[model samples]
Target: TRKVRRNFVAEKYAVLIDALYGGRASQYIETQVSYEDGRTNKVAAELRIEDAETFPPGAVKQAA
Candidate 1:
């Protein structure tokens, strides 16, 4: 049997709860990520922070 690995982990990153204040949903995001190669990347994407509260119990939000 063979296995495949994914480079990006979908659940590893997210927006801070404080960022959403009485908002119905998230519209955009600004993030900075550093790879193991010592390179940093900036990206913008549509977000839905409404589920921030529903995240699993042990999920941790990393600092920017």
Candidate 2:
């Protein structure tokens, strides 16, 4: 008699790696970045971006 192997066993044994690393279990809030001026910048939600269409009528260039 042949032994019955389960194909579902492999699918259930998949390993999931989390962002956790080292002895510290804290999650990173923002990534550390830098500018061309040799100054570092902390990335946060405070950054503001104006929509291109919301700019003043004459502020943007139009296609000739």
Candidate 3:
């Protein structure tokens, strides 16, 4: 008998909306996993923050 190992890569994207919840913030994130066997999986989540202002402006800007 032989054992096989699988390889996969994961990519993630996230965004934070300031003051979305009355002085708080909401962060949404999505992740995708791709496997060498042509299989794919996706996951998403949303988080609430109490002090989003602690982050500097343009800290999470998109790439050019």
Candidate 4:
């Protein structure tokens, strides 16, 4: 399916995922957002984490 299967597989890229979840959810993010009117404005948002599920130990082999 060309997917890395985030559950068990993403741990292979632990450092990168760690950086994403590094701090509190209430942290603010700032970036530039462009509008259709050809004008851009700074945007900010509060980062948050969401829940996900993982496959059972033997379940991963189902694809094979």
Candidate 5:
């Protein structure tokens, strides 16, 4: 999180966002991320997605 990207949410966490509604077993993958100490490390994980409860349609109001 040191070498911060402007749009890191979409770049990094898009998978989790997509899988939030539907469950998935993602394949193992590696990514190079920077640290606060200016050091870089290889981050690896096999992400497991779990389904989440959602509100009923039209249950929540949209933000203006």
Candidate 6:
């Protein structure tokens, strides 16, 4: 797993990372921000692992 950081401010933003194997998306990470209310906004982040080589089986770990 990898960690990415952005230093900026915006009203809406999206970040996506896709790992491709065999010409297909085997793993991905996504983050999205959208307006939800006048004072608050919706924020989401997702990580999906489908390949064993990319995401090994064992105790899950996060990159620093």
| Most accurate candidate by TM-score | 5
Ranking by lDDT: 5, 4, 1, 3, 2, 6
Query: Could you tell me the lDDT of residue 55 within candidate 2?
Result: 75
Best by lDDT: 5
The TM-scores of all predictions, comma-separated, are: 0.42, 0.24, 0.31, 0.41, 0.45, 0.21
Give per-residue CA lDDT, model 3, range 1-64, as digits (tens).
Answer: 4554332111112133333435555666666788999999987787766643565786877879
What TM-score does prediction 3 earn?
Answer: 0.31
Better of 1 and 2 by lDDT: 1
What is the RMSD of candidate 5? 7.7
Total backbone clashes of candidate 2, pairs 3 or more residues apart or in separate chains: 0
Q: What is the lDDT of residue 12 in candidate 1?
A: 33
Worst 10 residues of 6 by lDDT: 9-18
- Model 1 residue 2 CA deviation in Å: 33
- The lDDT values for all models are 0.61, 0.45, 0.56, 0.64, 0.72, 0.42
Cα lDDT tens digits for candidate 5, 1-64: 4786758867787666666645555545578899999999998888765556899999999899
Better of 5 and 6 by TM-score: 5
lDDT of 4 by residue, 1-64 (tens): 7866877556554544664678434445566788999999997676565555898787766454
Residues 1-64, model 2: lDDT tens digits: 5765565433432221122222333333444588899999876432232324477768979899
- Candidate 4 stretches with Cα past 4 Å from truth are 1-26, 55-64
lDDT of 2: 0.45
Give me the displacement of residue 9 in model 3, in angstroms.
14
